[model samples]
Target chain A: MSQKEDLSLFVREALLAGRPRPEIAEVLVVAGWSQGEVDEALSAWAETPFAVPVPRPRTVVSARDFFVYALTFVALGIAAFHVVWLGFLVVEMLWPDSDGANYWQAREARNSIAAILVAAPLYAWLTVRERRRLAADPGLYRSAIRKWTTYVTLLIAALVFVIDLIVALASFLNGELTGVFVAKVVIVAVVSGVLFAFYLRDTDRG
Target chain B: MNRVLFALMGLIGVVAVGTGLFVFGGPGTARAEREDQDRLMAVNDLARAISCAYDTAVLPEAIGVTSFSDACRPTNLRVSASQLMAGGLLTYRRLSDHRFQICVIVHDLGRSLNSAPYSDMTAGPEGAACLTRDMQG
Candidate 1:
């Protein structure tokens, strides 16, 4: 067993032998384990109501779980793209060139609108269904893939936020800080910030 | 509940149908809208250039010359519609003195071109595809 596992086993045994957690932690700390390590080791058995360690059921991601997750993330991806597209639309409208509106802007707006129209309602339905499932069995939150996807989303959002800042700063330095540029920066920051907030909350809750 | 599921399915069907209709029916309107917007942009560019050339010209002989074309070409302006120039769908011509005519083949005549900036422009012939505006020297 790994050192941490060994520590956890020792802590469990000590707890079962009626040794106080604090006393066990102190002994481990004095035996050269850091206080943090000792505390971490002790925490493994903190909530156990019995002397024997309970075996946690292995989380099996069934096909239905995979389907729900796939749908949810796809919908979220569409929603993110739509929001960014809308931001571009806003920029074009606010800072049109000397000529005026163009065909590309119209086409982009139409495409994004169509995508959001289809995806948003579907996302809502899927989310509601998942929420119901989660409410029924909170253990569904422990799905490894679900947690991994959420963390990956959080990472991507962080990267986007940083890139947005760099772009804004570059625009300002280049004296290209037009209304459109400002609007785009604000849009990216807000979208990424919201996503980060959401996933961070989910991770915390989990 | 089955009722909620049925209602959601019904809503999804409605959205799908609505989106289908919009997607199928939208191309023509979208094309017209895009064309109108392009025409407006081209007109605005040409008008500004024409006004600049007219103001800078010292003689009538110089009017509607190559210098006028040069003035029409702005650094940032790009006219993609061959109709606007090069005699494709629209024709721009100098009609004696300070008068000019921008003749366009518009698919939708019902669309009012008498909006801001283009309001000074007057339509030519009831069924003919042409517009007339005079430049001040």
Candidate 2:
């Protein structure tokens, strides 16, 4: 059998033998399996007062869940991007530079506003619908696609957060940290930071 | 908590869009800006034709469209009816032998007047925001 299969069998047998989880984990660690591997192997079974070890519900693949989650997150991504864009544009308008490019800046603001108008509502709707579904069936949170998409979103948000700070620091070093520039930087941070924090909490909950 | 965030986002989107629309005007503002650009382009074209054919064209008398078209024929530029009707009438006047002025109607004078090329032009009443040029210069 594969090493993973062996690990699973070992964990199940140990649990059935009425060994404490920490003792089993310590034994696995002594055998050179990582703590994460041991924990995953142990967590495969639910803790219950049953005669035998009971398996937890595994992550199921659902096409409908994939579609709903994908759409919801895509809409959210678009909305977040445009919201930051619009916020930057607004800051620029309020504290215009000496070049006086208000006309073009206003035009871009309109486009960002239009994108936000479409995507934000769609995001809100899909999110509300998904929340309702999740409320009705909390087990739906265990879908593999949901976990994957959530991680992907977290990855993007984290990247944005890092990139935003990098750009702000670069601008500061260049001595271009004007009021408008700093405001734009803060806007990006707030938007991406919110997404990162929200999804980080969500993944923890699951 | 998710619902609360969603509601907050929805509210923000609506408010931002409304403020943007109020500040930048609507889709019509973009259209008007384009129309103003086309009108300015036509004015430039008309001025070039006038400068090119100044020797053969009539002096002063506010250079009528027919006369402007006929003078520009030999220079291989035709002042089309559509160009004239794009924004409003294009008017040309010979200020002196070496200088001339062209004016066209603009929908959003405040925006167009602040922009490049147009910013250099002189603001006049509704139908006649004028850009003056010297052929010799």
lDDT of 2 by residue, A39-147 (tens): 9999999999799999988888988987988888888888888888777666655564533333576688888888887888887787777767877988888888888
Q: Candidate 1 on A5-116: residue-level lDDT in tens?
A: 8887888788778887779988898889998898767655545577565445445567777787778788877867675765566455546552333345546666776777
lDDT of every predicted structure (CA atoms):
0.64, 0.76
Instruction: Quote model 1's TM-score for chain B.
Output: 0.57
> Candidate 1 regions off by >4 Å?
A1-53, A96-98, B1-31, B34-102, B105-137
Listed for each candidate, the true contacts retained, as a fraction, are 0.00, 0.28
Candidate DockQ values, in order, are 0.05, 0.35
Q: Note the residue pairs that clash in candidate 1.
A: B83-B89
Instruction: State the displacement of the C-alpha of residue A105, model 1, in Å, after optimal TM-score superposition.
Output: 1.7
TM-score of chain A of each: 0.71, 0.72
Best by the lDDT measure: 2
